[model samples]
Target: MRISRLYTLLLPAIVACGGEGDSTSTTTSDQTLDVDSIAAAVADQNLPSDSLNEYLRENPFDVDALIERADRFIRSKNIPYAEADVKAALELDSLNPRVLLYWGDVNFYKNQTRQSRDAWMKCIEVDPNNVDCRLKLAELYSIVQNYRESLRLVNKVLEIDPSEPVAYFIKGNNIRDLKGDTAQAVRYVQQAIELDPEYWAALDYAAVMLANMHDPTAEVYYKRMLEIDPNHQPTYYKMGMFYLDQEMWNESIAAFTKATQLRPSDAESFYNLGYINLELGVNDVAIDYFNKSIQARQVNHRAYYGRGFVYERMGDLIRARSDYQQALAYNPQHEPSRIALQRLAEKMAQ
Candidate 1:
């Protein structure tokens, strides 16, 4: 019995309903039992280079003491202090690139998108060669779904420095969003990998593109990613999907089960497992898994549809109608649910 998991596409436009996708209906039960608080605790100290600390350490006499102060504030998530420090630095040196960059970052964290853009633009104006500023601005644009501008900015960075692996990674993402051209996206990511063999993000993106396309290179890249980072949850989940796609049911189940355990809060994993059960004719078990999937992800239309099908099989028309309607509520374009509802209606009329 080869259980096939759906080829789920990542939709950047869709904001997932936030919560742990657990099998319980209650809020507390829906939360993951395993809380890896250590990760959150060390998140602030993830990398000193990620702070302006390393940059400041190298360029000690870089005009603005306020920039370092702002970095400290930003790293601490002290928005007011960070903003005040940047403003004070700007007062002293209005055109300082470091100050502008920090200010832009603070603005971004604060969700002041327009202000962030303005600050980054100011930084670029002061230091046209500042790759960080350009890259950040490009990323900000991409976040706002302006892929064209993001691509242009990254292309500009590549024009200046052809060996910029980070730029290549961002360019690849933008290419995917704008054109859905997997080949071009893979090429850009491959360029990034060629520039920096240890580029894990590029490898992940490449793996995702290849896997979705059912390319033979997918397994190779996925194995390479695992070699670089064995415990990366996304890679594990993706590997599970790849196995499911390959009709390796036992392998898919193992991978998906591991993925769900690894990322307990991931709704998609539970949903995928449930989908596999549906294909495998484990109706009762499938129903249980689907219930968990819905509990984990309130807006998961697939779970609703699958549950509806199971309810139909059980000769429970009322539950079937409820699940079908719920599915339709989540996704009006869900054709399967619509057809199922129509059939149920016809059955009732008879």
Candidate 2:
């Protein structure tokens, strides 16, 4: 089963709810577990650029410093450096529950799912009341399509700390996937938002859920999120999509335009701009946007098809035929391109 893993689409937007827990273990289980060698052994061999020169020099072996640096590395897209720091922290205290949580993340993004799961489970074993670890496990389960287990883990987290808003959020996602119940999902996510009004992920999820039902309140959530962080490009894209679906052309164009401004290389947003302009009969502007979409990503068959349609409408059969052929070359299974090619052939024969 192919899991959507929507949460990973922009991890910086929705981070783990875990705290920096004490490295010391309270449990007697795994009393002789060799913790020092684990982190380095599990450190992923990869490369991205980051530097913690001052921190490494001053607090060479401090777990907190290493974890902080690792965090910086992860944010900078330097997974290898983050892993190295995790390894260093683990070597100092292999059973450091906090470091274990981070190690889970290091492996999770590395696509080492089992390793990530094991690290989180170890964190839970070391700190029985670690709600964050439980939540992480639940999220990982949800990512793998194990919604039942995800729910079970989330329930455990709630039992441990009823005030944990992220637990409710995770539970909401799992329930939505398991039962396809958007209304129920929205209720749980809304509960999370009520508990922690500043929870961005909860706000984003609730808005998306409400939008699924075409609920007008989704607009409120979108506006609130923009108020909180106007530069969040994904939110703008979502707002654009919502507006587009509602046929609010001006609003959609404005939102998508803002999205493109924030993320110039976003092919979909450019393509959407083209689509909207095309629908509005702004032929020249539509062509320009379509061309930009193709520039953003060369393999965009949709952009080719859209441009072909525009060309055909402009009575430029040659350009339309060329674009249709380009679309087919990119995606041989493009039905619209095939039909357009046939239609053009008949027109040319006339």
Q: Each candidate's lDDT (Cα)?
A: 0.72, 0.80
Candidate 1, position 167, lDDT: 85
On a 0 to 100 scale, what is the lDDT of residue 330 in model 1? Answer: 91
CA error at residue 320 for candidate 1, angstroms: 6.4
How well does candidate 1 match the true structure, expressed as C-alpha RMSD?
A: 11.3
Off by over 4 Å in 1: 1-65, 141-152, 177-180, 197-201, 220-234, 263-267, 294-301, 307-350
Residue lDDT tens for model 1, 1-350: 00111011121322222211222221221233211221232245563433444444465445465566556556665555456556657777878777778767665655555666888899899899887778878877776678898888888999888888878888888888899887998999899899888777778788888888888688778888878877788888898898888877787888778777877777787877878888888888889878878777789899898889988988999999999999999999999999999999998889
> Candidate 2 residues 219-319, lDDT tens each?
99999899999899999999999999899999999999999999999889999999999999999999999999999999999999999999999999999
Which candidate has the top score in lDDT?
2
TM-score of each: 0.66, 0.73
- Pairs in clash, predicted candidate 2: none
Deviation (Å) of 217 in candidate 2: 2.5
Error of 2 at 252 (Å): 0.7
